[model samples]
Target chain A: MDHGQIEATNLIDRYLTNRATPEECARFEEHFLDCPDCLSRLESTRGLIDGLKQQPPDTFQRRTWVGFMGWIAAAAVTTFAIFRPPPATPPPVTIPGPTLTARAGPVFTLATVRGAQADAPIVTVSGEFTLALDFEPAPGIKGFAVQVTSGTGEQLMSEVEHPLSASGTIGIGLRSQDLKPGLYRAVVVGKSVDGRELQRVIFPFRFQVP
Target chain B: MQSSGTGQSFASPRRSRQDLVSAIVSGDRSAEAELVDWFARGLAIILSRIVKDHQTVEDLRQDSFRIAIERLRSGALRDPDALPGFMAMIARNVAIEHLRQRTPGALSATAPDPTGGPSQYHDLARKQNAAIVRKILNELPQPRDRELLYRFYIADEEKETICERFGLSALHFNRVLHRARERFRELFEKRRSGGGIVPPLDAPDR
Candidate 1:
């Protein structure tokens, strides 16, 4: 399968919306696996579908009013609202905040700090947060084993063999409350399927709780 | 390795389908990993469309890969070039069997849970992408077009029904979809380049 065939059949859209037959689905998948362009398109289209589903019913609704009658109606409503007495204040309601999951935190990309400490990327994090380590994986490297440590060489977190995204990034969520404000380094080692290390990259950053 | 018009090179090296199959069959670990890496994302996307739960989708993906490897090793696949199609078929069948097992009045066995739930990375990516898409949808100028997208993609309504409801020709319907996808790609590229949360490594920081 090629881009021509993909466009001719509208395979990306159909496959995303579940409108494609099994045969079409198989063919498209096969094509995209080796085709980055198709893979990127598939991701964006899927994003569009997911975004549309998240929208409320009234998202696309439009409201229109007629001519002079519309102006008069609007004025009347405004006048009534201005003249009407405010309703009695309701009792204060205390609603509990929604519990925060690991995903509820803000994500920040951690990059290698090449020069002085003052030039290192500093992130102000409160509560839970995620640190995204982005790197280009060597050919045939599919995953990474990530280990994070403080400036003092104290190990903070370690994750074994996390899969790399198609866009070549891995994210690790952490809590600010767990560590003191200081510099940290993420030791990311690319790994093959058999847990063999291919390459190692270090990202240094500092976090201050505010 | 095929390069796109944009000059982006694919990571997978160019190898004949037969060579890859033969390599895997000869107990080449690199070949196995290469095969998995090539098809993992596509398989995940395909299975995720059919299965709702992230954990279940991941499980099905693994099952598909294992089954495909076993079949290839046994010389069950006649056409080496049909490997992709065969992988897709295996993934779909795995997903279907999983769904069938979960259905009521079917043979009752404890369903397997793989990896417990979706990884944090998957969840984060989904949330980030959805936010970008929502922004694009809101900025869409045409209410009709927005409604058409919602009805077609989200509602899963038939194309003919959508066209009739919107009083559009078949050609127009296709145009709307094409334009929407193009618009999305434009914004997605912008986000990637403009220092968004998940910017590429070389992207300049704000």
Candidate 2:
């Protein structure tokens, strides 16, 4: 807090900017050791630098601070739950959770997206989505299929085969070019080799694309 | 740009995966190069865990990526979101098969028994060091550079923010971000090696 400390505090900015010369760095270091004030200043500046570096450059907050985001999400959810309401008399909306088989998991599904425009290109849409699936790998059998539905509520595609070796995104390309864009949904039904619906897991996900 | 409907966090992985797919499908050579550049280290890590020979692992790492690219081109890899993971699995299985074929009786032929032969600690340590290096980049002098590095590369920010701030199209932003990441990687590598912070990774150099 004296003149030297005051000067040292300012010198940090200079050193960081690389404007400080070797002599200045040496001078700063010598004073830094003797004066606790400069030492604290130096550490604080380094801390600031480290803080700045680790931050997600797009935002002032760093990723290490990402833990706080959980709280934010919680707050949003809480607010939505409190303030958001159902559409006026929108007859008791029903979410149909898919019927689970006797298997341990949900069934695998293959699907595609379309646009409202007749010429709406499939290129505008994406195929990545999560599947609630019942995995019943029959030893050496490589592929399995459930069913597929088009955006128009029609069974435009079905019996799509997914291999066991493929765990991530299995590619079901737009096999048919004559697809119109609209709301599409699929019901993935499955059973084990014994033809009994398994029941261990029934994970389900819903999403949309343009 | 995506709608505020989905929010930012959810937008990134989906959007970028889409960008990569679009670029590859649209026949952008630079996108292919960028994908290779970003994934080289990840591929190397997968290769190391599988292949025993150091030289062979590096070669196989490159080979698997080439295979991945071929798959992308041929539409074998239909979904872009799982591209990297799929490629790694292919590399992993290939190495396993090669080891089994080479020496069925040799205990060392397959990947090291995950239990103890190799130091899993070293693997963890390397990951920590990389994280620390990422931490250091934010400490650099330039604010814009920090912003670019964090959002574009580390946090894996989507194309939207770049579009907002820079007003660049997807292709333009992709080009810029790709170069920015390269510069940042170079800086990170320099600091990492010079800091002499972590000793040469002790994972048997495999």
Compute the lDDT of residue A101 as modeled in candidate 1.
12
CA shift at A177, candidate 2, in angstroms? 78
TM-score of each: 0.55, 0.27
Best by DockQ: 1
Worst ten-residue run, lDDT, model 2 chain A?
A: A99-108
Query: Where in model 1 is the C-alpha error above 4 Å?
Result: A63-210, B1-11, B105-123, B190-206
Native contacts recovered, each model: 0.32, 0.00
- Per-residue alpha-carbon lDDT of model 2 for B105-191, expressed as tens digits? 222112233223334555554445445545555454543444444333322233465466445676655444334434434454565
Quality of model 2 by C-alpha lDDT: 0.39
Per-prediction DockQ comes to 0.14, 0.02
